[model samples]
Target chain A: MNPSAQHQDAEGARLGMWLFLFSELLMFGGLFVVFAVYLQRYPAQFADAGRQLSLFFGTGNTVLLLTSSLTVALAFEALRQNRQRLCQGLLGFTILAAGLFLVNKGLEWHAKFQHDLYPGSQTLRQAPAGQELFFGLYYLTTGLHGLHVIFGGVILSWVLVQVRQGRIIATRPTMLENGALYWHLVDVIWIFIFPLYYLLL
Target chain B: MGKVIQMGEYFRRGFLEPSGKQPALFDWIFSTDHKRIGLLYLYSICTFFAVGATIGLLIRLELIAPGRTIVGPQIYNALFTLHGVIMIFLFIIPGVPAAFGNFLLPLQIGARDVAFPRLNLLSWWLYIFGAIMALSALFGGGGAPDTGWTFYLPFAGETTTNVSLAVFGVFVLGFSSILTGLNFITTIHRMRAPGMTWSRLPLFIWSLYATAWVQVLATPILAITLVLILSERVLGLGLFDAARGGDPLMYQHLFWIYSHPAVYIMVLPPMGVVSEIIPVFARRPIFGYWFVAASSIAIAAAGSLVWGHHMFVSGMSDTAVLVFSLLTFIVAIPSAVKVFNWVATLYGGSIRLDAPMLFALTFVLLFSIGGLTGLILGSAATNVHVHDTHFVVGHFHYTMFGGGGFAFFAALHYWFPKFFGRMYNNRRATWAWGTMVIGFNLLYFSMMVVGMHGMPRRYYDYLPQFTHLNQIATIGSWILALGMALMAVNLLIALRRGQHVGANPWEAATLEWTVASPPPPENFEELPQVSHGPYDLKRAGEA
Candidate 1:
């Protein structure tokens, strides 16, 4: 007979989380491939479309996401050291940063809407052939990334609740670590998206 | 924690037993037990299969005499589309992996449950949710999509049908598939018993491992592709619209990028099932365990790169066609290696021509025929003639249905007693198998013949010259349906009234056979220690 031992396998849980992150990377990786293919096919049009996107908003969102990622990472570290208050503070900061990023994104999309740059808008219909494709991809890639941001924020908030209840402490911080890992993934995806859309111009 | 539940009580009460304050039905719905979730998948997938099969019968009826004998062209188009979507997405893709893999992975690896049991339950729920969404398109606005399941763009993008909703439904299903893959991969990697090393792992687990990698890596491409299609239909994104400077071929590339590998997702586990069953029935160690295990990985790897083969007639460059055709041929080698090993395993053994064994043998025969014809389709010159004809249709059905579908039947028969604690009538099972084999070949072989005569597919009408073969094929459909009905009835009766059997009824040596029939809620009272290969019949005999 096998040993009658029962304990939570934190390492296995973390490994599963990391594997899930790999899948997330590849999900976005598919979009990146599409972007790369289309960019090669219509270089000038993509460059023009990229320039039309506001560098101010894109850069602001990128900064917010990067800051959030750092805070989430630090939150896990603080929780590991049993500094419950500091961990909660960092998680709250990360959530705030994510909210700000989405707010900035909403404003940027609204400006695009006002200018009729959305796919199927009258302005896009009148634009050059590749320009429509560029904007189409722009909306899809960033829009998908934004959804991830929202999901990451929600996961972090849940983890924050757990920490507040003392359920996720130094000895039991797998949930905290996994949430941070997901938040870092969201940030990392934006790192790629920022360059592809804003800086590529 | 107050009073321990007996193993027999757990089996009898099922995973639907109430926990804490929850009601019984709610317990089943939210149960994280892998066994309950596996049964959930089994019930839903079989229901979908019945729907798909009915649609298939209607298609045959319409084609019974070359011109539409049943439904109108519009309804016909919708029928075939729904049939393809239901079969591919709801049935075959999740078929073996979701049902058998969920039930057996932890059992085979000697674990209490999958690495993420809660996530496993979530996948089953998502499957149900996605199925509902896909079926909703059939009732309201624009009716079911008329675009073939492939949903080739420009047509798919421009169709008035509710392609958007159906495509989005598939997107959700893809998430379910991805989660299942992730759960299985992690379980295999981290949850093996102390002695179940890689070499000592069953071939079925190895095939599942290969299949899981494919599902994780490839399904996202499909998810993204479907999302793009949704954007195109809903927001008029025009990513694949020709007038919008998008190349329609790019959509094909993205789609088959997942879908071509998806063929493996549909078949590899069944191939794994065959690998598991052949040895047990033959009562021998598999002829070449390493070769069979390695070939599953090889097929998975090579299968991904051969997506371009599907796009041969999509007007890609000649060079692209040449490269893809060559890769397609290369992919067949591993499959051929598996067939060779399977036959070798049966070379000189105490062969039992049981229902499960008969089905496995038929799978080997039919899949070989399917794979060989695939070579004709793989060659650019030959494929040009049979590209969208009934030949391609015949070839695909043979491979998927004959190979994957039959292998699933084999697994069901092979593992039925173990999972349900009941023994079905062997005579009726054999009769069902015989009728199916005859009906299957008659149906698909005629399609291949008419295809060679140049009968185009996805049409409501055809020339008089093809009528005879079409009629024959329709007749074949009747037999196939009859066989399927009998098989379902037989298994249903077994579930309720069949004789109870002990564990290891087949005298197999896998870890599952080491536990009770309809295993306890926690799978093993104490995880059995593994000291040898999964098919060590010598050890099985000594024990």
Candidate 2:
């Protein structure tokens, strides 16, 4: 009848979540390998393509994700201390940071589209082979990381709702803890991505 | 299902019995019971395996003669591709673990269910959905993908077929696998009953433990690889296209990075099955238990590093090739250690020549032949000679079918009575085993022989010189098919009206047999306090 029944183990949930996160990281790890390989192959052209990205937007988004990571951790800590209101507010801020990060990403992509710098565009078609692949990797890695940010926001938002409803409390904080861990991973990935894509010098 | 109306007196409501609130179909689909989920996988994969096997038989038939046998080249290409996709992802990869592992893991470790039961159900649903998406690619608008299951680009990217949809399906399947692995790892780590230490655990659980790790760690790479293929297909990204400044070898590297460890995910549980069955049938503590357990983990760890062997003839660095070849050879040592341990397990004990034992014994033979040939292919020099040949094909089937596939059947027969509370005709089961072994060896071994004589694999047709052996292999397909059909019929008959069995029909000393046959809805009426190891032969006297 009951699915979990009497088998609830918070430590088990944490272990499961951690293992799931490992899989998530390894997915990105594969992309990093591909990115590293291509960067090796076309170092000069990749730098040229990297310069085409607005460094200002890249830096701004990196800061936004880092701040959001902090907020999520603080939110998790607040939940443990039973400061539900502070936890909710911090989670809301984290979600807001996620939204701003996406907006910045959108504006940056629009700028590239205006320049015909995206994959499959005529401008990219005419570009050198290596630069075409460079933009390709750029869009792929950043786009995937963006998706994770969206997913992370949803998770943190869910935890916020659950905490407000008393479903997630100090006595049972696995959901909040795992949600924060996921958000942190999103930030951690962007930390690699910011330098890997933008700060290539 | 047994549906044994006559055994109403002994019929205890199993996890098989649907909860009373809803329709039976709805109850089964939505139920979080791990045993039910395991059966769901068993049924779904059996259907997929039938489709894959039929396609394989046709492929063998087309190769029976020279050019223009049953289908033309395009159709033949679709045939082999579909066969490989279905068998590898849908059937063999999920075969032992998803079916037997889900059913037995909780029962073996003395848990009510997996660590996450709802998550377990979700994994099954994802598996079914992904299997649908994969199969639907055939009938969908773009026609069947012919880039092969590997889907190596730029062909995969450029193909007008449903490569995108098919790969997206596999991507979803990768998630299913990862979740299953995550669930098993958690269940093992946290849900072991009191006193069920790691060493006292069954070898099958150990193998599943190793397999779950590979599944969690390695399958995500496959997911990412497939996603990259989707990007290339949909966005015209040339990440894997060499002409667009992308390296084709990069795709190979990524694919095998996951796909190679996947071989362990496929075989290790069956090795666990053999390990579990051998000691029980031999009536002895497993010879070198520590060595056998450690070897499963050793195989998993070593298997991941050897993916480059698959890429040797596809063009790779000489130094990378040398290192991968060495690692490939080294991976075999753990497997050999397992084989010798199983043999040593069978030695000098009061061994029963039952059907499960028969299949387990043949698994050692077939897997060894397959594994030994793998070493030959693992060598840089020999691999260059037979890289894409039928020898490689034969070796794969030997390990996959003869090893994993046979052990799956052995597990079915081994645990069939325990799960169904009924026993199949053992003589007929032994006959089925005999038929399958003959057909399996005749089919795969001939391919190895013909492959050694220079027959390239996956060809729709062959030269006049390669015709006879191809015909023999095709005939071997028929025998294999017959054997499979007989085995299926035998099990079906047993399900309907086999002799009712009690708990511990095999007299094997394990936690599962200590409970009622078909088991109670919650596995144990009371939690078991484990003091003895699973196979304490002195404790397990005559039946």
Best by TM-score: 2
lDDT values for all models: 0.89, 0.89
lDDT per residue for candidate 2 within B1-543, as digits (tens), equals 345465475465467676778989988888788888888888898999999999999899889899998899988888889999999999999999999999899888888889999899899999999999999999878789898889988888887888888898898899999999999999999999888999889999999999999999999999999989989888888888777788999999999999999999999999999998998898888999899999999999999999999999887989999999999999999999999988888789999989999989988999999899999999999999998999999999999999999999999999999878889999888888888888888899899999999999878878899888888888888999998899899999999898888888888877888777888778876677778787786675221
For candidate 2, give the docking quality class from DockQ: medium
Residue-level lDDT tens digits of model 1 in A59-85: 888888888888899999999898999
Q: Where is the poorest 10-residue window by lDDT in model 2 chain A?
A: A1-10
Docking class of 1: acceptable
> Candidate 1: which stretches are off by over 4 Å?
A1-7, B1-24, B541-543
C-alpha lDDT (0 to 100) for residue A178 of candidate 2: 91
Alpha-carbon runs more than 4 Å astray in model 2: A3-6, B1-9, B541-543
Tell me which residue pairs clash in candidate 1: none
Model 2 quality (TM-score) = 0.98
